[model samples]
Target: MTSSSKISRRSLLKAGGSIGLLAAATQIKTSWAMGGRSRVGVNSPEQLLALSAVDLSQAIRTGEVSCVEVMKSYLSQIDNFNPTYNAVVSLRDREELLNEAAVADADLKSGHYRGWMHGFPHAVKDLATTKGLKTSMGSPILKDWVPKHDAIFVERLRQSGAIIIGKTNTPEFGLGSQTYNNVFGITRNAYNPDLCAGGSSGGAAVAVATGMLPVADGSDMMGSLRNPAGYNNIIGFRPSQGLIPFGPTKEVFYQQLGYEGPMGRTVQDTSMLLSTMAGYDSRVPLSQKSSPSRFAGSLETKTQGLKVAWLGDFNGYLAMEPGVIDLCEKALKHFETLGGVVEAIDMQYPMDEVWQTWLTLRHFLIAGGANGLYAKESNRVLMKPEAIWEIEGGLGLSAMDVYKASKARTSWYHALDKLFDTYDVVALPSAQVFPFAAETHWPKEINGRSMDTYHRWMEVVTPGTLSGCPVVNVPAGFDHQGRPMGIQLIGRNKEDFKVLQIAHAYEQASQLTRTKPNLKKA
Candidate 1:
């Protein structure tokens, strides 16, 4: 059977009318190009935003745009729309942005352009430490804390000529999918004021969606990048874990579930940032030395004959939103038409076991690292329930518990290997539901099934995170209510380039990227 047909039939049987649930709103009107340069794989307002990163880069290279002008455009967008969305927090020193812009403009006059990123403005997830900048990681405990040096990735960004405009918001300590913090408040969706933007890169998603920034950097531990990208109708990429390095961290939190990557309006833009961010680091032992290739180059790879596996549900715990599965199925069909082969695959892993295994390791690691904060009285007040839960989870985990979980990782890894051996790529809903209520976390109950944990509803991202595979969250389309949804392409570990190539091809073929969300004014 044709892959698309198989998917359609399965989704119709499993999700039924779930796909009919409509999004509450659409994205606001905005310019798709930065300097009259159109982007590839873009069709709608949603796709137009995805073009932001690449368009800005092109404009800077061609001297058709000034870094100052681009920054101002995004700054103005943030000022005009952020109060409604609360996506950006702790903006860079405005004077600093101006000064940086002036420097870039001078380089243009001197004929000393700085490669592809001379004057672009970008932001990172608040969790990434920035030198001399306040990075609260969404907790009141460290609200006044500022680091003395930039995270390795942030420094690389500056060297690449991306003006760091500000830090995006996240849930406390980057734990939940909803973006909110005690210090900076909540970040709402750009498409609908009352809907969520998705987390822990939720703010990054909103910033790109509303044109506040052309491209933003974010981290994913359990689908932060993928979920928000889908939630906000943008592109979020989580590269192979070691592709982007984290350094100068004494704690191994970087090794657990965390991976720093980029989010943008288009796949090309996402690729550009990834290329700039990737490379080797002596400090990060896990880092791989790679001859950096511009991610944009891989977009040229053809998708014909690419093998893909569609795991619409892994053992049935991943429930689909009625239309979400349908839209994603259509997107998969586009892949087939592009000469790719897709097939259904059954994975051998219990949903609860995988989640529990994840929680056990994640909590154990984060809790141990956060011990110092727990000892501090002031920091304790700012500690979130999730943080406390993790701490407690860590405390309760015996050495045997950890060892057992560690042993389980082997089985999970083997299962992933077996699956990858059969397919070049795996497709799944990026998030089971369309953007949920912006005011609260994902529903604890969906269609009467109890979602026992904050992470339970987001099981779709687990496979990628656990396997350390490169996963790209491609915008699918909006449901009836206009809320955005997306599908994920999970490639084998170290196959980051291949994943991007497939997504780039599918993006070009589907024409779904052309759809933009209408920004709702509160």
Candidate 2:
């Protein structure tokens, strides 16, 4: 998967998929090279579950591993771990998935490879609809309602060779960071089954961290991707706005902040998934025109003399749990070691103004998107409090208020834009605190600072969200409790590849990413 487009579509037929076969063979020949390289595990069931998506794809394409073997390994992993972590839900029956895997294997033998994913097993975040699979959105209201059409991203995943096995859990309406709902229950942390997995991409992150999925697809609109990756010790990349076209929804033009992205154990793997997930869609007019295959290119970038701004706690403006800052600061030392200059920078824009702007847009979108539920008294009764709060806030807003909020968002983007003038990337701790207990919803307080709202504790993520830039959550070291943390690297708006490159370099330099969680079972 390192170089997917290496075999051009036209040449794919002429060469009889020889380019992929050669590359796949080479990749299979090399086993699990660390420092941002894909992990190519042995073909046995346990080791097959351990292979990175890229490595697994190569092995499958090259006939080193069968799709049925891969499927059984992952299904076994899910059966073993998912019951306790609940990372995967609405799983299709094992016999059905195995039959599908057999079909994929048959296609492979016929030299009818679908795409880069070529027979890979995958589970989408519960928010995205998969033709026959339940989307639930972590709400009981939609628990049984299966969509006839797939989300734009899901369509691409299917177009590639990914087998849609089931859905990963999420928060109700994806309102809060915590991953729990009456429908699916909690998605526990991959490291500790009792702690928060960090949602709405919580289950996606946990599945990837625990090797239940080779690489997973997730979306980020307020750290749904980043925070969970931080919590689970995996990679979550939120590509720049319009990089991945979002939907075929009713309101396409105004859906600004959130976008689909990828989660994986390695930057290389995430890049491979991103290629399949991105590209222009007519339904999403704002979608970027450039070919997404560019993202799947080599991730080795020269960080020589790169400049990174450490926006730690926003110069004491944002609250942090003890040692969070120190952990990130130590992580930044990797950048320094790579000949990159690191500087502690203060918040360029007013934190309060940014917070207010985020509130306005988030509320406006939630209310408008989920008005179907919020408007009906019956469905409203089933809605979570956070969803209700956001909807109510949005309902109370005037047209002028939304206009002002957009203006404020523009102003914040401009402020961060100036920092990019001197620095290649702006770094921030992915979250203010370590992963907390799954029983706890949102953190009520960080250290001694009281949160004003359910989402206030996760304020560290909003700047990156509001910037509409490319942000990648790389592994920051863990706490004394052995809880994982992530440091986000925010790159220029369209510099998605650059961010991945720098993150790759940092990942290679830092020893943290090499340590996988000692999995705990309930």
Candidate 3:
């Protein structure tokens, strides 16, 4: 049936039918693309999926392809792969998505184009609220709760004409790097379903990696975006703190650590999504007043004569899995070929103190938000054990502990700022270890060194998080096992555009983003 005719039938069914009829309507054999053309399995879904968001947006704008065709391609891929990967949860009804795509196509025909993301199918991280969609946050306690309004970032995506497909999986309240939670189980790596997809942005990374979505949105407090991007072999950019504000909160003037950003298969696609997400708003007190045009324009910036600092394992203080550092170092060499001056620099901050400060403040934040949930006798049982431990740990923290951590964080920022004076960007491995077993919650040790806490193994990303710098995870290469690895490019605070420029240069030279996962057996 034609796309519009199918939508019309579905609309009639919805108007006078039971939930069963709506469910059945989703299974109708609607045309997979516009003009009654069938692109599914005939035209390559892989090729369509491989197109950058910029290229895809242009295609939609120029009438080369309809938004319906694009949406159908992604929905087909998700149906074929999401069951095994478990990357996307809380999916909307299929008929409803196609109906929206039909509307987007109609709007385009009438010259009512929205923007770059017009008609693109995208998913928000489960942590963010999407009005009328389940905002589970990967917690069973909220399994059925739908938000009344979209989060700021989600609202921006909608305004830009991106269709909200579903919520990507995340850990409960996004507390850990690993993406598993009691609600949706585990979100496995796109490279290998047996291994974990690093999280709490794991699902977002996997969705992009597996062609389930062209690009996705995620947040980072402690490398939630970067770690998953590293594991999945994609680009995850954590913009500088306040570049994209954290909001819909009670305390507006608080010290912000977490920031929302974009994830995609390539740096250019990520920049496109970032442009839509970032802007100044009085509602988000920490939001920076900057033009989104800076991000898109910065992609054309050259890397020649740029000073690139290579920070290997934080000067050997961070424990890395075997071959992780070597892989990252090899990726760093590519910058030199692009005319970047690569320097081996030591960021000589007390590593132990940095970790202590990060933990103290992280736990403090966790406790402040979660302690109330834990206080409810009936709700306590719904919380995860690690979450409970973190909340209780925060309860025991003294005011002096928070103060000391804040002081340490300030000192670390000064050290980072001093290094930036001599370097354009600092590069390191995005994750300390490659993808591990999906069953494991967190790595207990790295290279025989014991990890005191569940999150200690992920200390490589904490420095960037603590410093509030713009960090981008670009595909580095693969290890012996062929699991993906990535290099983190840390830019000076609020120099988000420069960071994207550097990452884009390295991405173009390396071309590692072109590599696709082998999901045949998966």
Best by TM-score: 2
Pairwise TM-score winner, candidates 1 and 2: 2
Q: After best superposition, candidate 3 residue 327: deviation in angstroms?
A: 0.9
* Candidates by TM-score, descending order: 2, 3, 1
- lDDT of all predictions: 0.77, 0.85, 0.83
Q: Model 3 misses residue 220 by how many Å?
A: 0.5
Better candidate by lDDT, 2 or 3: 2
| Model 2 CA deviation exceeding 4 Å by range | 1-43
TM-scores for all predictions: 0.90, 0.92, 0.90
* Cα lDDT tens digits for candidate 2, 162-277: 99999999998777888999998999998788799998899999999888999998888889999999998889999999989998888888889888899998898999999999
Clashing pairs in 3: 177-199
Candidate 2, TM-score vs. the true structure? 0.92
lDDT of 1 at 380: 72
Residues forming the 10-long window of minimal summed lDDT in candidate 1 = 16-25
Tens digit per residue, CA lDDT, model 3, 331-403: 6767777987766666556788988888889889889877777998788888888888889989999999898
How many collisions between residues are there in candidate 3? Answer: 1
